[model samples]
Target: MTGGLEWAVTTDGQAVTLRQVAAQAGVSRQTVSNVLNAPERVDPATRLKVRAAIESLGYQPSRTARSLATRQAGLIGYCLARHPGRSLFTDPFLHALTEAIEATGRRLLVFTAPEGAEGLATYADLIAQRAVDAFILSDTVDGDPRHGWLASRGVPFASFGRTWPEQGEQPGRWVDVDGAGACAELVRGLHSAGHDRIAFLGWRDPVPVGAAKDRQRGWRDECRRLGLPEQAAYADSDSMEGAAHAAATLLDAAQPPTAIVAAGDLLAVGVISEVRRRELRPGHDIWVTGFDDSLLATSVEGGLTTVRQPAAEITATLVRLLDAGPGRSGVLLDGRIVSRSSAPLDL
Candidate 1:
């Protein structure tokens, strides 16, 4: 192997480091950096010496170390983890978030959960690898430990659909819509439509208490606020199949609900489909509502009534927080109820 060709350039006798390059060039490390970053900042003679030394030593800066110095990676991490058959690509909220994150001069590095992953493994693996400068946590959990872990490690993170706990110290790092408030609005909209027994359909407990859990919490709070019938409350697996089956169960209950507020658009669409299957008119027999404005929401010919959260507004806030170096730590975005055939337009 050694006799074939001596293509190996020996680092043994050459200095391939910034420090060595600077030393050989008879300049400080800062001067060499100035020559590369702001050539005008250094005198012509000094710049020439640094350039010559860099060439002579064949010095190549490590991307990781360079990113550390610049505080920007030109890439952003996006964690995409959900169970099978989930409508990820069809989700408008996620697509909007993706475009928004990309528009900020950063690329999205998606990290999906490996087979059978649970708990904090995603966060740990990402941090350990140091593959991204910061991470975009979509549909994060309430009181999520990932945020705390990132905070302690000083790694930046942003949430899309869900919210984390208030840091008390830094207050604008995460982005979220008012899940609870949106649910309340849906219930009130149903209540005003001559529908008294309104039910909430959500997944009782996802691996992490994601935004669906927040919506369920909203359902509970709204039930207390409006004094609507509570026994009809139900949960699915945050999927269309789960929601469809759950809707059937609700229909079989002793006293079926007249209207349903789904935690997600897919769930609501399932309810709507179920209503039609039962020969019950969507708006009359049972009003249906959803969140996220996903295809499941507006995909129906007449459109499904939903609470629309502005992805641009929330994502801008998140990108701002990340770009500004975690100076702020949390944000609660608002949602608005959109009138459609799925739910009566009482608002």
Candidate 2:
């Protein structure tokens, strides 16, 4: 291996060509081109042979030339909704989804867009510049204009969350974890563990079409069905501090709950903090559970019992949906309970 595809030389110090690679692999010139442009269309055995020959000869395909031939930049776009004081890195689910995208061998181009109308212009500019082949939209809301806007522009995109019921008529591809279902499952597990007074900690703004509301509804419905006392509380934010304050209030109520299930891991951490502050033993005196098995769930002194969303699977499904383009129905995956020291594990 002479190294460096651009400066690589043959045994006699000559530049390599596609024809030479095809000949060395004992394949047709068209086969070599297909392997480079659309490997999925080529037989796996032939694809490997061509790849090995290219590596052996250090032949790098011309990116610019290939782009012109295929009209594909091989890039997937993701837009982050920038909040006033929040960083995108704080979302572990996003990190996992990004990892899954990276594994697909497509370059990911991320952009930050302010919420509301300002995002419209950003989307236009990205498309105008031909910066990406498709986009991935997460945290979808009811009547999400991004979906409509992208549809009007005929831009291929996929969402990690499903569209709201009102936006059911909209055209787009989407995949989401069944957050509401997951929460209901948590309630069932806790009920089996002999916990009757259950409290739910969630975000303050429960948009009718947002995933947070979906999860909250799940908890409420389950509590009602099980004939358990239902107490609902809201946190200003998903941070530990916000959750801690909310959890404290829930505990101070006249009839405090024996168990708390937060919508996210960060909020659950806050509940645990308050439980400790009040001299209450987590998982014993008061069981706490959280959704999204984030790093904080396991890194803490006692592991948190939470629902683990299949981020990797969601990512893969989103890519397939985007590749398949719009008109295909969205997908919803189930999340499983992850037992830890914070909650009972038998169920």
Best by TM-score: 2
Assess candidate 1 and give its lDDT: 0.70
Please state the error at residue 2 of candidate 2 in Å: 22
Model 1 earns a TM-score of 0.69
Give per-residue CA lDDT, model 2, range 54-152, as digits (tens).
Answer: 998888766665556567777888887565224222366567667666656566888888666678888888888877888988766776788878877
TM-score of each: 0.69, 0.81
RMSD of 2: 5.5
| Residue pairs in candidate 1 whose N, alpha carbon or C atoms collide under 3 angstroms | 171-329, 171-330, 172-328, 172-329, 172-330, 173-329, 173-330, 202-236
Write down the lDDT of every candidate, Cα atoms only.
Answer: 0.70, 0.80
Clashes of each: 8, 0
For all predictions, the C-alpha RMSD in Å is 10.0, 5.5
The regions of model 2 sitting more than 4 angstroms off are: 1-15, 19-60, 84-105, 165-167, 206-209
For model 1, state the Cα shift of residue 230 in Å: 0.9
lDDT of 1 by residue, 1-347 (tens): 11211122337685356677779999987787766555666888898899898778876444456567565666778766565346433255556666777666466777776433254687677667666778776655555556666767778776564433433543337677788878877777677767788887876554344566667778778888888778444444666677888889888898999888887777788888888889999887888888877656668958899888787787777777777775555677778888798776777
Q: Model 1 off-target regions past 4 Å?
A: 1-71, 82-94, 113-131, 161-172, 204-208, 233-241
